[model samples]
Target: MKREKVKHMSVKGGASLFALRIFVTCLAAAAWWECLFSVFPGMVVSRSWLYGAGLVLAVIIGGAVSCPRRKVAVPAVILAAALLCWRFFYVIQGAAAHLVNAYLAVHQERGFEVRFWEEGSLSAGTLAVGTAVLVCVPLLTILLLVIRWGRGKLVAVLILLLPVLAAILEGAFPSAWATWMLIVTGGCYLTAAGAGGRDMAGPAGAAWAGTAIAAVTLLVLGGVSVLAGRAADVIRLEEDGFYSQTRQAIQTGVVDNLNAVRLRMEGQDEEADDRPEEEEQLPREREEDRAEVAAKEAPSASDEQSETPGDSGAGTLPWDTEADGMTDLASVARFSPDGTAAVDVRLEEAPYGTVYYPLRWGGAYTGQSWEETSGEDGRDSLFLSWPEGLDRLEELCASWPSDTVEEAEKQIDRELTQKAVYDTEPGRTPTGEDFAEYFVFESERGFCVHFATAAVLMYRMMGYPARYVEGYAVPASAFSRQADGTYLAVADGTMGHAWCETFEDGEWTVREHTPASDGSASPGSETQTASDSALRHGQAGDQEKAGPGAMRIAGRAALLLAIVGCVIGAFFLQAAVRRKRRLRVLGGRNRTKAVEAIYGTIYDRSRTMGMKESSPLREETCRRMADMWDSIKEQEMRWLYQLVLESMFNEKRPSAREYRKAMDIYRKTGAEMYSRLRGWQRWKYKYIWCL
Candidate 1:
C-alpha cells in the first residue's frame, strides 16, 4: 500500500512538472509575439486589439495542443502549427524582411534600395492571424518540446534568445518585457531542472503555481517595459569606462552579424540589388544563373533617354505625375447604366486590328489616380517578370497610334471605327491603394473599367508607355456593308468597353484583353481553357439536369465517405506505426527505451478482458491479469511490475536477459488475457486497439 501511494504521488509530480513548463512557455511565446506585433504593425489589419486577440488565440492553441502529456507526434504538431499560422508564413516573413530593409535603408541612405513602396503590403487583419499562428504557435510547440524532452539547457536558451534578439535588432524599444520573459523562462527551467520534477504535487497545483509565476513576471516585466519606453535615455547604461566600451563593441558586432544573416536570408549580398531599376530582374534570386544572364542582357539606362517634366510628378506613371495620383488611381466614374456609349470607334479594319481604339491617355501612374505625364521620347520595355505576380505583358501591337494618325490627335481615331461597341460598366467602388490594385489583386468579378485599369498598370510596370483608354470595341462580324461599299458598324450604348494602348518599337498598339463577361471563356479570351469553361458552366447545369444531378449528389457523397474512411484508416495506421516502432525497441538496441513496450503490450491485451480500470500501470491491473491464467504465475507477474518500475525510476537500462524474460511473459500474458475475454472483446483488444 505504501509503494502504491508512492507511485501515485510520483505520477502527480511528473504531471505537475510538465504542466508548469507548458504554462511558462506559452507566456514567453505570447510576450514575444506581442513585441513582434508592435514592430511589424502591418502583420494584420491595422488594429492593436485584433493582433492582441490573435496572440491570445495562438497562445491558447499552442498550450492546449502541445502539452507534453498529450504525446503528440512531432511532425503532426509541426504540421498543425503550420496550418494554424499558414497566412503569416506566406506574407509576414517577406513583408517584415522588406520593412527591415526599408528601415535600414533609411539609415544607410545609399545601400540596398528596394521597391517595397511600389508593392503594397499586407492588410492588418491578415498579418495579425499569420504572426500568431506562425510565430507564437510554433514558439510554444518548440519550447514545450525543448523543456520536456529536448537535449540540454543550452538548446532552450538559444530558442528563447531568437525573439528577444529579433525585437532588439528591429530597433523596437520597450522590449524589456520580452527580454524579461526570456530571463524568467531560463530561470524557471533551471529551477525545474534542480527540482527534477518534484516540488509540485499535482497537475492542478502546478497550473496555479505557473499562473502565479506568470502574473508576478508580467507585473515586474511589464513595469520595466513601460519604464524603458518612457525614459530610455534616462536609464541608459552608458559611462566612460571599459565596461561601456565593451558593451558598445558587442552591440555593434551583434547588429552587423544580424544584418548579414538577414541579407543572406533575403538572397542578397552586400552589393546585390543596387542595379538600375529599369533593368530586367527575376522575382526570386535563387535562380542565380538566370538573374545573372538577365543582368548581362539588360540595356543600360543611357541607351534610350526620354524627356521628363522636372517636377510634373515624381513618378514616371500617370498617377505619379501628381502626389494624389499615387493614392487615387482610377476612382471609377459613377453613372446609372442607361445604355450610354463611353466612346464610339470607326476605322477601316480596326486601326490596330486587335481590340479597340484608345484616345485619351492616362500617363504617369501615381498612387491614387493616373497622372498624365508628357514624354514622347523612347519606347521602353523591361521584358521581365513582375515582382507582385504581375507578368509584364507584351501587348505592343507593332503599330503606333501616333504613326497612323495624320491630321488630328485622338479625334480621328474615335471617328474611324466601324463595328460593335461595348457599354460603360456599372459604377461600383474599388477601394484600397487604387482601382488598379483592387482589380489586379483582389477583384474576381468586376466591370470592364477594372480590366482596362489593371491592363494599363501592368503595361506601365513593364516599362512601356501605356494609357488607360475607355473606348468602344469593334466586333467585325457585327458590322454590315453600307451602300457605299464600306462597312457600317453601329455604336450601340450596350457595346461600350475599355482597353489599353502602348507605344512599342515606334508604333502604337492596342490590347483589348478583358475577361469574358459571362464568367466562362468567350471564343477569343486568351486567359482560360475549355476545361475551365466546362467546369464553370457546369455549376448551373448540374442543378438543372435531373440525371446529372443525381450522379453529382452520389459523387459528392462518395467523396465524403472516402474522406471519412481515410481519416479512420489514418488513425489505425498511426497506431500501428507507433506499435511497430515500440516493438522494434523492445528487441532492438537501447533496451531502456524498449522497456515500456514490455508493459504496454500486456497492458493493451488485458485492457477490456475483464479489467475495470483503464490504467495498465496499476498494481491491481497486474494482479487481475495474473488471476486470468489457469495456473497462477505469481512470480512472473511480480517481476513484470518490477521491470516497469526500473524502466521509469532507474537510470540504467534493463539487461538483455531481463528484456528476454519480459518478452516471454509478454507472450504468455497476452494468451492468458485473450483466453479469458469474450470473442468480440478479445478481437477488439487483440486486433483493433491492441494492434
Candidate 2:
C-alpha cells in the first residue's frame, strides 16, 4: 500500500512539474507578443500577436503530445537536438559567407559577382564536399541514433526531418532555404512529439484512457483552432506590416525643415511694425543719414547707400540673391485626385507599402487637377493624374539627336551613366554635396528610392510637376498567357517592386530610365510567349480590377488562409510522417531536468500576452487605455486583463468562448486607437512600445 501511495505521489509531482513548465513558457511568449504588438503598430496591423500566439500554442501542443517518459526517450531527444544544432551550424555558415562575399564584391558586374557559394571563400565546386559531410553525415547519424539507441516513436522524428532538410537545401536561394528550413524544423519536431496522440497511464489502462483522452483532445484542439482563426483575423485587420509610420516621420521632418528655412529667410526682424510709411521713413532716414554723412561723404555716398538695402529691408537676404531656378524643390501631388493620390513618405526600418498610408508632397510644385485629365474612354481614369507643364520633358525628348527608338535608348544609356554612375563608388553614403555630384559620387548603386527621388527633383529644377508614386511592380508570373505573344498580369506577392509613374498626355505612364536603358529586361519582359499576345489586351478587358481596396481584401484573405492552412497542414503532416515510428520515453537521472527545461520554455512563450481578470469599471478602463498600452482598446483591455488574470489565477481553465471574446476585444481596441492618432504620432507610439 505504501509503495502504491509513493507511485501515485510521484505521478502527481510529474504532472505538476509539466503544468508549471508549460505555463511559464506560454506566459513569457505572451508578454513578448504584447510588447511587440504595442510597440510596432505595423505588427499589430499584421496580426503578428496572434500569429506568434498561435505558433507558441503549436509548440505546447506538440510537446504535450510527445510526452516521452520512458527509458529510451533520452537519447532520442538528444539526437534530435544534435541534428538540429548541426543543421543550424551549416545554415549560419552559408549565410555568413554570402554576406561577407557580397560585402566585398559590391563593384563586380552582375555576372562576374558570382551569386552562389558552396563553402568557405571557395567556389561552387567545394559545395559538394560540405553538403556530403554536413547534410548526409548528420542525417545518417540521426537515423543511426534512432535505430540503435531509440526504442519507440522517436524514430519517426528523424524520418520527417530528412525530407524537410532536403527541400530547404534544394531551394537554391539562400534566404528562402534558411527561413524555410527553420519553419520545417519547427514543424517536424512538433509532429514527432506525437502532437496528435493521447495519454494513457500504462499499457493495461492505455486503451480506455487513451480513447477518453483522445476525444477530449480533439474537441479541445478544434475549439483552439477556431479561436486561433478569429485571433488571426483580428491581427490582420490592424497591422500594416511596414514603413507607414517611418514615412510619416520623414515627411514631417521634411515639412518642418522647409518651414524653418522659409521662416529664417523671412526674418522676423522685418515685421510689419518695423516698416514706417515708406515715404516718411525714407525721408527721415535720408535726413539723419545726410546729417551724419555730411561730415564723411558727398553725393556719391548717398547714391551708393540708396542702391543697396540693409538688414532693415533695404538689402536683399543672401538667399534671395541666388540665381533663379535654384531654390529647393516643391511638393507635387496627383493633379486629378483631391487628396486621394497621397502616399506615405516616412522612412522605416521595416518594409511597409503605400496602401495603409498616403505619401504627402512637401515642396512647391503644382500640377493639373483630375478634371484636366482624360482616360481612354474620354472619362477620368480612377484617381489617375500627373504633374503638368512638361515643356522640360519635351526639350529632353527632342534634344537626344536620335529619332529612332534604338538610338534614343543608346543615348539615354550614355547620358544616364555619365549623370549617374561615372566616377562613383558602389555603396558609399550620400551627404550634403551638390545634388548631381552627390548622385554620381555615391555611385548610383542605391535602390529605386534614390534614383526616383533624384530624378523627380531634377525634373522639378527644370520646372515640371513631378511626383513620386509607390506601388507593386508585378512580375511576369502574375499574368496569364493568351493566344498572342503578349502577357496579362495578375497581382501576386512577388509584385513588391518599386518604380515611378509620371502623368503625361492625360494618363499616368511608366517612366523608363536607367534600368531599361542599360539593357536589363523589365520584370514582365521574358515571360511573354509568342501565342500569348491576346493577354496584352486583357489589360483592357471588362474586369473591374480590384484597386487598393481590393488588393487589401485579397491580402487579408490570403493571410487568413495561410494561417489556417499552415496550422492544420502542419499538424496533420507531422502526425502522418511519424505514425510508423516506435515511441521512446525518457528515463535516467537528467531526464527530469530536460523535461523541466522544455516545459519551462513552453509556458513562458504561451503567456507572453497577459490575460486579465473580470471586466473592469468603465472609469478605470478609460484611465488605463493609454495609447501606448498593448491591449486592443482602453476599455476592452480591462476585459482582456480580467481574462488573463482569470487564466493565471483560477484553478479551472476558462472556457474557449471566454478566451475568444477577450482576444477579439483586444484587437478591436487597437484598431480604434490607431484611427485616432496621426501618422507621426502613431510611429512614435510604435517606437516607444517596441523599446
Candidate 3:
C-alpha cells in the first residue's frame, strides 16, 4: 500500500532529471580520478593538475552523445577531443616517458619519499597510441552509464566513493569543501536513482526541491569541514606504541614479499654473491684484537665483532643494499672512523637522561653497511635477514618496563648486553648475507654497528619504521659549567655513533635500541667512547600534516549519510510541489488551456507508450497517430488527441462542468496508455521513462 501511494510518477521531468544524474555521474568519476592522482601526481607525468583531470575525455564523449535541441553535439565533442589532445600533447608524451623510464622518480614538489624506478623503454608511436587508448577506454566506460541510470547503482556508488575511500586509506583527502560536497550531493542522488524507483519518478518540481535540500546539506557539510580543519590545527593523536608496531609489522611483511618478488624479477644474484663459490682454506690475515672504546681510545667497528653462526660463509664483510636493489659491500671491512669534526652543535644546558639525536636515516641495510634506500616512504624494509631475529628481540622487549620509552630502553641496555657479547674472535670479522640472523641467534660479539644494525630489524619486527642512523654522538658527560651559569659541550668524530631510530608522529626519533655501554665486554653499543644521543623526534605540529584517524573517518561517513537523507527528502518535497502545480493549472484559472495542457501531456506520454522504432510518435495528425497505434487503445488515443486539439484551438473558455468533462477524458486516456504497456514496460514507462 505504501509503495502504491507514491508509485505513479509523472514523465514530465524525466529528461531533465536524468541529465542531472548524468552530470553528477561524470563528476563523481572525475573526483575519484583526481583524489587518487593526488597521491601520485607524478603518474600524470606533466605534473599539471589540469592534465591530471582525465575526466575531460569523459565530459567530451558524454557531450557528444547528448542532444543539443538541434542535434549537432557529436562533432563538437570530437573537435574538442582533438584540440585537447593537440593542446596537451606534451602531457601525453610525459606520461609515456614516465612509463618508459624505469629508473624514474617523481618530482620533489610532491614531497613524497624520493622514489626511483628502473630504466625501461618504448617507441614514440607506441606511446602515443597507448596514451590515446588510455584516455578513451575509461572515459567510454564512464559514459556508458548514461544509457541507463535507473540501474548501475553499485557501479555509480563505487565511482563516487572511490576518492573518499582512497582518502581514508591514504589519510589524505582533498582540502576543498566543494569537492566533498559535490561528491556527497551526487552520491546521495545517484544512490536513489540507482535504486530504480521507477514507481516514483520525480516530477518537474523535484529539481527545485532536490536543489533546496541539497543546498542545506551543502551548508552543513561546509561547517563540518571548517570545524574539522580547525580541529586539525590544535588536536593531535600520538601513535599508540602497540598499534603502531602492529601496523608496521604488517606493512613490513608486505614490503618484504614485494622486495623478494622484485629481486627475483630483476635477476639479482645477491644471495649467491653473499656466499663464496669455493670455500678454499685461505690463510687468515692477521688483524688486531679490538680494545674497549674509552674517552681516549676508539675501537675499530669491523674488528670488534666475530661470526658465531654455523651458516655457510658466516664470516663476511658488512654489506649495504643500495636503493636500487643492488649489493655494494665490495669494500673491505676496515673503515677507520673519521677523525674530523664534520658537524658541530653546541648545547648550552647539561644533559643527564638518555638522549637520542638522529642524523642520517638509512632505509635499507646491507649485511655490511646501511643505505639510504628507496624513498621517503616509511615502508622501508630491511634488505637481508630482515626478520630472522625479530621474534627473540620482541620477546626480550616484552619483559621491559612500559612506564616510559627511556626506562624501557635502559632495561634493553642491560638485557640485550646479556644476550650478545662485545668480544669478536681474535682478528675475525663479522659479516654475511644472513648477518642479522647470525647476530640474533649466535649470541656472538656485537659492537655499536652490529647492535645498531640488528636492533633496527628488531624494532621493525615490533611494528616501527626502524631506520638505521649513523652520526656523531656528543657525550653528555663532556659538558662543563661556566661562570655565567651556562653549560657547554664540544663534540668531534671520536664521539661517532651508529644506531637506529623509529618513525613516530611524522618524524624519526632516536631510540636507544643498541645495548648500553659496558667497557667490560670489549665495548658496548654507541661504544664506550661515544656520547649520548643527538637527534630527537620533537617535531613541531606545522612541520608535517597528520593523516586522518578513525574518528575523522567516522565523521566523513556520518556526513555522507546526512547528505543521503537530504537527497531523499528533496524528491519527496518535489512530489508535493508537483501536486500543487497540477492542481493550480487543472482546477484554477485558464480552464480551457489547463484541460488542453493536460491532454497534450497525456498525448506526449502516449508517443512513448508502445516503444516503437521511431520515437516521440511524430505523426502530425490525430488520425495518423491512431493509425500507428496497433493496440486496442488506438481508438482511445484518437479520441484523446481530438479532445486536446479542440481544447487547444477553441475560441471561448470552457465552463467548470465542461472542463471537468475534458479532464475526465484526459484521465481515461492516461489510463489507456498505461494499460497498453505490459509487465516491466508498465513500470519502465511510469518510473524509468519519467525518471
- The lDDT, on a scale of 0 to 1, for candidate 3 is 0.45
Candidate 2 on 497-582: residue-level lDDT in tens?
A: 22333334444333334342111112221111111111111111111244334545555665666566566555544443433221
What TM-score number comes out for model 2? 0.26
lDDT of each: 0.44, 0.33, 0.45
**Can you write out model 1's per-residue Cα lDDT over 1-691, one digit (the tens) per residue?**
5346434644565555555665566556555555554444433334464446554654454455445544455556566656744644556574455445544533222223455443246666655554455444555555655554423557667776665565456433324444665566555553333222211121333234434543554455445444343222211211233433454455357644675587789888754456554221111111233222222333333423211112222112211122433223344532122222222222332111122322234555444455543344324332211224233122322222434322122322232111111223323445444455544433322455555555565545444555654433434333322233333333233344455555655644454455443321111221111111101111122323434335434444554555555565465456445544554555567777666776776665555544565567777777887775543376778787888887888776788788777765664454445445575664354336643
Q: At residue 259, what lDDT does model 2 achieve?
A: 46
TM-score for all predictions? Answer: 0.29, 0.26, 0.30
How many clashes in candidate 3?
20
Question: What is the descending TM-score order?
Answer: 3, 1, 2
Model 3 residue 638 CA deviation in Å: 13
Error of 1 at 668 (Å): 28
Question: What C-alpha lDDT does candidate 2 achieve relative to the native structure?
Answer: 0.33
Q: Mark the regions of model 3 whose C-alpha exceeds 4 Å error after superposition.
A: 1-23, 38-41, 44-60, 68-144, 154-189, 192-691
RMSD of each: 28.1, 24.0, 22.8
- What does candidate 3 score on TM? 0.30
Residue 678 deviation, candidate 1, in Å? 48
